[model samples]
Target chain A: MSADAGTDADAGADVGAYADTETGADTDADANTAPDATATAAAAATAPAGTPPDATPWRRLHPLSLLVTAQLLAGAAFGAGVPVGAGLAAHIPFRAAVAWVLAGSALLLAGGLALDVLRLRHTRYRVGAERVELRTGVLFTTRRSLPRDRIRSVDLTAHPLLRLLGLVKVRIGTGDQTAGGESPLQLSPVRRAEGESLRRELLRRAGPAAGGSTEGRLAALVPRWIRYAPLSFLTPLLAMTGWGAVMQVSQWFGAEETVVDLVRDTFSPLPAGWTVLALTLLFLSAGVVGSFGTWAEMWWNYRLEREPDGTLRVRRGLLTTRSISLEEARLRGVDVVEPLGVRLSGAARVDAVATGLSRRDSEENDLSTLLPAAPRAVADEVAARVLRAPVALTRPELAPHPRAALARRLRWSLGAALVPVAVLLLLAAALSVRGLAYAGAATAAVLLPAAALLARDAYRSLGHGLAGPYLVVRSGTLRRSTVALRRDGVVGWTVRQSLFQRRAGLVTLRATTAAGAQAYAAYDVGEAQGLRFAEEAVPELLAPFLVPDDGAVEQPAERTCPDRWSPVRT
Target chain B: MQVVGIDREGRNRGPGPAGLRLRPPHHRVDRRAVAWWRTRLLLAAAVPAGVLAVLGALLGPARFWLLVAGAGVAAAGLAAGLGLPAWYYRVHRWEVTDDAVYVRTGYFWVDSRIAPMSRIQTVDTERGPLQRAFGLAAVTVTTASAKGALRIEALDHEEAAELAEQLALATQKTPGDAT
Candidate 1:
C-alpha cells in the first residue's frame, strides 16, 4: 500500500543506487533513508571496506518454520483430494455434486493453511552480491543457490496479502531447471522497503537491459502475488443467477410443482426440476471452491512486476512470500498446464523449462500463471517472448471457418440426432409426433451448440507461418494455440498416418524434445510438409529434451562387426 | 538330404563349409502351418454341412446335439491350427547382435528373419508364462518403421537380455553411421 527509499542513510543509505535500478524511484541526493529497512544495509552503506562484522555476518532463515508446516498441509490436502474426488464420484446418486463441494471446501481450507506456511517459509531467503540462496522443499529437502554472476534476471513480486504481511518473495532465475523453479534463494517476507532494495541489488548484479527484445518470446509476465479469486464462484454464480431464479419462480408458484407432479404421475417419471437445479449448483460450487481455494492460496499472496531489463518477476506465497525473476534468455522451453477445471474456462498455466534440473523439480509451481482463462495469443506471446524469439504469432487473429456449416455438417448432425428416434419408430415403439419432439429436444440442445462449435473451431484455425530460424508453427482452431519452433531447436520429428488417414492422404506430425513430443497429430496438412518437417524441426526442437541418463554416455567402442540385429521386413 | 554349416558364432566344426544347404524358409512347409490350414479349410467346408447338420439335428432325434458336435469339432480344429502360430509369434525369442540376431519359430510358417544390427534402433525383450516354461524369451529389434520390426523367437533368458543390451549399445553408438 505504501513505499520508502534512499532517505535514511544512517542505516546504510550509501548503497541506494542499486535499489533504484528497476523502480525508477531513485534520486542521487538522498543517501540517508535507503538503508532504513535493515541494520545490515545501513551499516554496509556507511562502513569502510575494513569494516568487520559487528555481529555474525550470516543471518539464519530457520526462524521462519511455521509457514512450511502450512505448505505440507496443503500438499496433503491435494493428495487427499486425488483419492476423494475419484473415489466418491461413483456413489450417492448426487455423488459428483457432493464430491466437488467437499473437495472444494477442503481445498479452500488448504489455501488458508498454505498462506501461514508460506509466511514461515519466507523468512529464510537471504541475498548477497555473490549469491542469492533460497531454501524450500518439504520432503525432498532442497537449498537452491544462484551465483549473482549466473543470475539472468531479478523479479520482485508483492500482492495484497503479502503487503498485509509486510513480506515479499524475491526469485532469481539462472536459466537453470535442475532444481525446480525455486530461486537460488528467497528473501522470504522481508520489509517492503528492503525487498525493493534487494531486487535492485540483484538487477545491478545482472547488468543493464538492452536490445529491442527479440521476436516470438515476449509474454505478459504476471505478478507473483495477488488476490486469489476462486473460479468456482463463476459457474455457481451463473447457475444461481440464472437457473436459481427459475427455481425460485417455480417454488413461489407451488402450482408449478403441482402441475409437474400431475404430469409426472401421468407419465410415471420423476420430474424433479428443483433437484436438477440444485445438482447444477452443487457441481458449480465444488468446482469453484477447489479452483478458488488454490486461487486464494496463490493470489492471497501474489505480486508480479515487469523488470526494466525485459524480465518478468513474480513473488507470491500465502505464508512464505516467494519471489523469482525470469529473463528472456533464461529458458530452454515453455509449457502450459491446463488442469481439467481451468480447461472449462479455456485457461492454461505457463512454466519455463530451464537447464539445471527438469521442470518438475526446478520450476517451482510458484512462478506459474494463476489465470483461469488466458487467451491463445497470450500463450503464444508469452512462450515466444520468454524463450527469446518471435512467437511466430504474438498477436493472433480469430478466423471463423465454415467447414462444418455446409450441407454435409447439417446432414451429419441431423442424422446423428435422428438415428435413435428412427430406430425406435422402426421398432414400432409408436413414437408419435409428440414423442419425436421429446427426442428432438436433445438434437437442439446437444447437437446445435456442438455444430456451431465445430464451425467456429474450423474458422478459428489461424494460418501458420513457419518462417524464422526455428519452424515457428502457429495454429489454433478453437482455444487458439500457436506452437513456434526453431527449425534447429527440435530433437526429432515423427510422422505417422493411420490406415484411415493413409487412405485420406493425411499424416500425424509430432516433434519430440527431451521433455516429450509436441503433438501436432491429427492436423490436416500436406504430406510434403509433414515429410519435410522431420528434416527441419527435429535437430533444434529435440536438443533440449535430450537428458543424459546420469551422464554415463560414452563414445562407443569399435567392434569387428558380426553382432547386430537386422531389420524386420515383412 | 541334410545340410551342415558352422553355428552362429562361426565355429567351423561341421563338414568344412562345403555342405548341402536346406531350402530357403518360404520353400519349406511348416507342419503346424499346414495342419492349421487344413482345419480352417475343413471349417469352411462345414458351413453348408453345418446347416444340414443343424436341420438334421432338428428333424432327426439328435437335434441340438448334432449341431453342437459339428461346431465343437470346428472350434477344436480352429484352435489347434491357429493357437500354436499365435503362440509362436507371441512367444518368440532372440539374441540380436550388431549385424543380425537369430530367429526360429513355426506355427503356420516355420521362418526366421535375422535383421542386421545396423538397421535396428531399439531392442525389446518380451516374455510370458509359456516362454518361461522354456526358460526362454523373445527379442525383438525395431527400427523406425513397421517394416523394421524383426522378431527372433526363443533364446535363453540371460542370453536374450544380454543380446538386447548389446544391440541397444550398438545402435546408440552407430545408428546414423551403421552400415
Candidate 2:
C-alpha cells in the first residue's frame, strides 16, 4: 500500500507502524533454551527432498518448564511441611514420609524438565483451511482439532517471567466448560511477531474483524486510542460521592449526641466552625482516596484494532495482558457511552457486548470491556467496522423524563429525610429546637443536592438505538454500559406487558443469548420497539446455534422436563 | 481398542484430510462414552460445594447459613473438586494426524480440539503414581491464547513425547503451514 492510501486508511487515527517489529530482538532471550539435539537431527532428516539442506527450522514453542517447575516446587513445599508436622506431632517416623516427599518432588521436577523438552520436541501446530489441529503424545498420542470458525475468543496472557522473556501465551476460550476448566491449547514463550501472525490467521480464518479506525475524522476529537493509556476515575468517584453522603447522614443523625459530647470535651478555646472545617477536610480526603481505588481497579491499557475479517480485536491488560477478538456478527449491539464530560467535550467512550459474554458479573465485566478511549464518531466508525452497522445515537430516554427527574429527586430526598424530620419535630414538641436545625441543614444541603445529581446523571446516561440486527441499550453514569444483542442471535425473547409499563406505554424486553439472558432496562423507548427489536434479534443470532424442533412430539404439560441437561447445553 | 485409553493398536492415527488423507492410522476413542463419563466427573468436581451448601442449610437457620455455607462450601468444594482433574486423567485421549494434532478429553464436556502444526507452541509429558500403576503417562500441548498460552493435557507420556519430537521435526518438513 502507498503512503497516500495508508494515510487515507489511518486518516485521523494514529498508524505509527502497520506492525511493531523492534520487539523481535527482545523475544530472543527465551529462544535460547537448551537446544534438543534429537529434534535438530530429525529436523535435518525430515527436510523435504527439494528443500535446501541447511534450512533453519521454524522456532518451536518454548516448553513450559521453569514456570511448571515453580508450580510443582510450591506444591511440594506444602507436602514437605505436612509430613514433617506428622512426624513431630504424631508417633510416625518422619524419615520415610520425608523421603517419599523428596521423591515426589524429584518426580515433579523431572516431569517439568522432561515436559519442557517434550513440548519443544513433540507438538506441531498447523492452521488448515477448515481448522487447527494439535498432535503430540507418546504411546497413546492425542490430537485436538478445533474448527477455526467455532472459536469464541482467542485470549492472550503473559506471566511476569514470560513477559521478561518477551513471550506471551494465548488461550482459545470456547464457552463449553462447566467447571470453568482452563483452556486446553496454549503457545507460551512465543515471540510477539509470530503471536500476532497466528492471531491474524485466526481472524482471517473466522472472517475479517474490523473496529475503531473507521471514524473517518472522529480520531481528532477523541484521543488516538494508541496514543492513550486509559483514564478511569468514574466508578470510584461515584462510590465516594455515594458513600460520603451516607457517612455524613449517619454522623449527623444517628451519632449526633455522642459526637456532641465528644466535641464538648475538646479544648474550650477551639471554635465550632474551625472544628467542622477540619472534620470536613479529613472526611472528604478519605472519601476521595476510597473512590480512587474503585476507578483504578478497572482502569487498564486498552488498544482496539480492526482485524482483516471485519471483527473487532480488543486487547487490554493490567498485570496480565489479555486479547479478545469479536466478530461483527457476534456483537449484540453497540452504543456510545457519554458522561457529562463527553457530552460537553465531544468525547465519548464506546462499549458493546458480544454473544456469550456477560458484563453483570464483575469477573466478566473485567473481561467484557471492549473499547475505552474512542470518540463518539470514532465509536460510530468502529460500530460500522465491528458491528457492520452504523447507528446515530438519539437523545437519551431520561428516567422519570427530564422534567420529572428533578421531581423524582426531590420526592426521594424528602422521603429519605422524613424519619429524621419527624424525630426532630417530635423532639421540638418536647422543647428542643437544635435537632430541627440539624435536620433542616442536612436535608437542604447533602440529601437534596446528592439526590438531584444522581437522578440527573441517571437520566443523562440512558439511551437506546437500533442498527440492523442490533438493539443497543446504553446506561450507567460512570462506567457507561451499553449492551448489544444481535437480533438474530436471540434464542427466546419475552415481552412483558406489566400493569405499570403497559399502562405507561412502555415495555420490558428480555432476550437470551448464547451464555445467558439479558433483561429490559429502564429506557424511555416504547415497548413496541423493544418487542420489535427482540423479534429481529431472535433469528439473527440464534439461527446458527438453535437446533430446530423437527416435529418431535411435545410432552404433556405436567411431564417433568425431559432433558435435565438442557440448561448447560442451551 | 476404543474402550481402552491405551492406543495399543499399532495402527496409530495422524491428522489429514478424510480421504486424500496421508494421516497416520490413528486411534479413535469412543467419544460418546467419554463424554458421558466426563459430564459426571465435572459434576463430581463440584460435589463438595453442593454437599457443604446442603449441610450448612440443614444445620443452621437462615442467619448463620451464609457463614456456615461459605466455610462448608470452601472445604467441600476443595475436597470434592478432585473429580474434574481425576476424570480428566481417565478420559483424556488423543489422535495424531498428518497435518495437525487432535485431542479429546472430559467425559461430558468433550473437547475435540485440533491444533495445527503452525500454531502449536509446545508439547510435554508427565508420569505420576496413577499413570505408573496403569503404565500410562500424560502429555500436554500448549497453544497461544489471550491471557497466557493454554496447555491441553491427557497424552500417553512417552509416546506423546516422542510424537512431539516427531512433530517438531515435521513442522520444518512441511512448508507454508509454519507461520
Per-residue lDDT of A221-284 in model 2, one digit per residue for the tens? 2224422222334434554676566556545335556655665676346688987887666555
TM-score of 2: 0.45
User: What is every candidate's alpha-carbon RMSD to the true fold?
Assistant: 18.5, 21.4
Model 2 local distance difference test score: 0.46
- Give the DockQ (2 decimals) of all models: 0.03, 0.02
Per-residue C-alpha lDDT of model 1 across residues A1-570, encoded as one tens digit per residue: 111232223212222322332122212211212211222333333444342222212233332334544545666666665455545654545567466857785776777667555444422444655545443444333334455655665555555456555655554455332222343444544556676786677666334543553332233334421122343334456545544555555554344677567645654543577656655666566655555555555544343445565555655555444466655333335545434344455555455543233254333544444222344455555555555564423333322111322333345555665566566445444545565565656656776677655544443442333445544343443334444444433433444444444333333455433221222332433333333334344333222212222223233232223333333222
Poorest 10 consecutive residues of model 1 chain A by lDDT? Answer: A29-38
Please give the TM-score that candidate 1 achieves against the real structure. Answer: 0.45
Report every candidate's CA lDDT: 0.44, 0.46
Per-residue lDDT of B26-142 in model 1, one digit per residue for the tens? Answer: 111122333444444565646855775767666778776777777776676566555555555342333333344434344433333334444455688887765565566667765
CA lDDT for candidate 1: 0.44
Q: How much is B33 displaced in model 2, in angstroms?
A: 39
The parts of candidate 2 lying over 4 Å away from their true place are A1-61, A64-145, A175-184, A208-302, A315-322, A338-347, A358-366, A373-381, A390-441, A456-472, A476-486, A489-492, A497-506, A511-570, B1-179
